[model samples]
Target chain A: MATNIVWHEASVSKEDRREKNDHGSFCLWFTGLSGSGKSTLANALAKYLFEANVQTYVLDGDNVRHGLNKDLGFTDEDRKENIRRIGEVSKLFVDGGQIVVTAFISPFREDRQQVRDILNENEFFEIYVNCSLDECEKRDPKGLYKKARNNEIKHFTGIDSPYEAPVNPELVVNTESQSIQESVKTIVQFLEEKGLIKSGISNGI
Target chain B: MATNIVWHEASVSKEDRREKNDHGSFCLWFTGLSGSGKSTLANALAKYLFEANVQTYVLDGDNVRHGLNKDLGFTDEDRKENIRRIGEVSKLFVDGGQIVVTAFISPFREDRQQVRDILNENEFFEIYVNCSLDECEKRDPKGLYKKARNNEIKHFTGIDSPYEAPVNPELVVNTESQSIQESVKTIVQFLEEKGLIKSGISNGI
Candidate 1:
């Protein structure tokens, strides 16, 4: 049945918000196996950007799975679907003129590429939290690796499933060796060099 | 089952990004029906913010449905899921210390409230794009109203489904009575009043 009501209408354009924020929006995607320190680096980078007075946000995998993606399981298809949803969300963030950092296992190459395709060129920076599987198991912050090794967990990346390393990442943080300070410095330097942060350097960092 | 590996820590924090960007990260959500001028406003807002040197991005409904929300259909579950994913993504953007403007129909009040809950109290700004149904029908740029009238589409908000009006919005823009110039001015004025923009008003406007 047709109704005479016209419901779709909203005001405020994208250009206006972008002008107010001062920096171009993009997604910083961090991919690695469980316990690879993707969350740690992403959080630190976000902090650095925050101090610099840049608009920013982070998507931690554990937090998301607990809420927005709660219904999703660990099956390969489910994981792909999960990444797909995150990708779309990331795209929205980019549109809003904010730097978006996503920390996820995102073990599939195709899925990561799919996310990149959704945004503008050079907006999606792939940061591989490069840590050996053995290293990640050693620092199992959530004990996920232990459960995976014990067969209590199924389809765990780097245990039963695969983690496709980035062939060419914009940045690769070797979490196994560098101190947190040094890692953050590298990320901050990258943002500064990219001109993402203009004027001051200590507002949102 | 736990192995040890060196972890690289970051020196900086999100505080630094905020200091540099000169503004806090948050979500500027634009809600209305399709062709209600949401995308147009969102895009223009991004542009304006960019010109003012504010970090920004825009998330339009059509653009998102084409990619991140592509796998899902138009069922209620899918719609909820879509908004949920967007909430998560906006959180990430705010974490990155960037401003975000999202334009979507976002028909239901509950769903919109869910997105607001995902954000910090002051971080979410609900900008209701207020336009009467009659004017919206006249501005049916996509001819969607025509399709709905012919029963070519189902579950369309304002046609077959219901649109829960926003009870309290941060800002309301009546696109019908206001010219794009006036509408943009209203938004810029809001940002200025909120201390988001530092540059002077656009002479062009």
Candidate 2:
């Protein structure tokens, strides 16, 4: 305990990075069903934030599954472990002074809570991307829903598996009802209001 | 495959982040025996980089073992997994456009090579913090050497286990001979010469 206090008092690496970057660093965790348009919205927001000069990065299945979590499978145990590692990586990004957007169908309340418990207050913002299962299945961006229907994939959230939504998320966006541009604007506005980022977004955007 | 190209051509998130942060991002991998001043020198270099307005963070056993790689142990296989996870996390930081300094014993050549292979060209810099085992045992910063000597710790690098030094490290600093300030300056100068960072360090420093 004493050592931790001395270390924090002596070496404020997070504070130094935030000051240098001229912004607050935190995780914008987007959770929902598999086909809930999480990747599209998260990438769009990342691009928008980059245009506004906010240091940002996105951690989706594309970058993660093939490398860090390749050994993990779709079993219940592996699902929890996957979310756990992603949460830990998000914390590192937060400490590095960048806004990290993680688009994962983190389907367990306890698992999500574990991540929230690990981060400092105001560092973990749960953004629940809401889309009805019917809608998501209808869209089926990656065709995983069809495979799940054919039993080609097991433990699929909203089909064979369960998706436990956030009990009290910081923000909830229903992508089915809103245009992508409007959804992106709403998130940017929320970030601006929270003072997590400065307002440099051009009016034309 | 086409999607990745389309995404890259459409959006350059990393380039955007680097421009905003005003510096290139990469990993400074510090490998050495325990108590060899790896942590001390990495932290000192981080402090120097932070003063120069370079986004920087150090991932050492203190911050990492308790969080990201908490499940990993000192066994040979776990050690490999530990380094692999750290390498992946470092890649995320680079994508986030921040210089991440990792200080670990990381004794195996193949393990270090795996990290280098995962990163893009110019994105990984292996820094060998060379210290004689005799000097390291004498300093014994954390009393780990005493425990290792008494057989309280097993598979300890430079003791019961072997430490494979880097054959073609980008840089090597002998903490036993050079002052901490001098070592930090040497690193800063190297970064400047490599165009990874600009020479903004004032003469007063």
Candidate 3:
């Protein structure tokens, strides 16, 4: 190597990216029961944010469970570790100045709290996708509820296991009472009002 | 709640992001001994890419070890798990339509090959930052080499642990023979020739 060779002074900072992206960055953590429309809401909102020129990505079981957390099983310990890794990954996306929307059952309050502890006060906004168990079971989007009822899926959340609902979430969208677009619009308006995202593109709420 | 709203046809695809960012999305995986300038080169190239309006992010020990892989230790199993998680995260970035630059002393060929298998053929590019052990030890950028020599660090690559060099790397920059600028220029030109990054900005070699 040349004697004069030196390290660059800095890498691009999160603020630099936020400025370039023209929006603040944070995590929109959507937790809900199976068939509660968490993934649908998360993806819909991500698409809306992308259209509005906000750097956004969705982290859901479809992308995460089979990839990053494949080694983890459905055991209690594995579930906790799964949430921890996902939280850390979400933090990285936020660090890159992109809004990361994650959809996971995340049944435990402790697991959700751990993720919150890792981020700043305003960086993690938990949005509870509220739905009655009867409604979720009726929808059974993935047939998970049927499997759980059949004793095929042991310790399934909101069935064999318990779901500790968020006592004080940043927002709550009752999926049973509203359409997906309505849920997306409510969240977008909330984010815009909170100054988490810039007000430019009309979300057509 | 409105009843007419429906799921969008698609979220942003990798192709859409590639066209939007005007650059190819892939992982530039840098592997070498400690103090071999992997982080420096990765960040410098990332800075260049960002300046060219390419969506780019770098995953290094500074950002990852203390957070995503904080629970992992120096054990062989832990190291393998660490690399696995990093590879999976890189795949997510590529899926999101951004070039991800990763700097780690990933010492196992099998681990590196696993990451390659997870990604498409062109998505994973292994760049060996070749530097002589003598030169790296002399640099001692983080004093890690000194600690390893003093037996203060266990399983330190190129000292107590082995570093399996790439059998068929996409590129190898001899850091012992060139400056950082030259290395960055070499990589930028190589990427341009391969159409990994669009040819627009003239990188001054």
> How much is A174 displaced in model 2, in angstroms?
1.0
Number of the top lDDT candidate: 3
Model 1: per-residue lDDT, tens digit, B20-67? 676666888988876678878876766655555556666666666777
How well is each residue in A45-127 modelled by candidate 2, as lDDT tens digits? 88766665567889999889988998899888998899999999889888878888999999899999999999999999999
For candidate 2, the per-residue lDDT at A14 reads 81
Query: Could you give the candidate ranking by TM-score, starting with the highest?
Result: 3, 2, 1
Q: Could you give the CAPRI-style class of model 1?
A: incorrect
**TM-score to native of every candidate shown:** 0.75, 0.92, 0.94
> Taking the tens digit of each residue's C-alpha lDDT, what string does model 2 give over B97-143?
88999999999999999999999999999999999999999999889
**Deviation of model 1 at A70, angstroms:** 3.1
Kindly report which residue stretches of model 1 are placed more than 4 angstroms away from their true locations once superposed.
Answer: A1-29, A44-58, A90-101, A116-128, A164-205, B1-16, B194-205
DockQ of all models, two decimals each: 0.14, 0.24, 0.34
Off by over 4 Å in 3: A1-9, B1-9
Q: Candidate 1: lDDT over CA atoms?
A: 0.74
Query: In model 2, which regions exceed 4 Å deviation?
Result: A1-10, A199-205, B1-10, B200-205
lDDT of 2 at A72: 94
C-alpha RMSD in Å of predicted model 1 compared with the true structure? 8.4
Q: What does candidate 1's lDDT look like per residue over A32-88, in tens digits?
A: 988888888887776566445456777776557876678899887888888887887
Q: What's the lDDT for candidate 3?
A: 0.88
Q: How close is candidate 2 to the true structure, as a TM-score?
A: 0.92
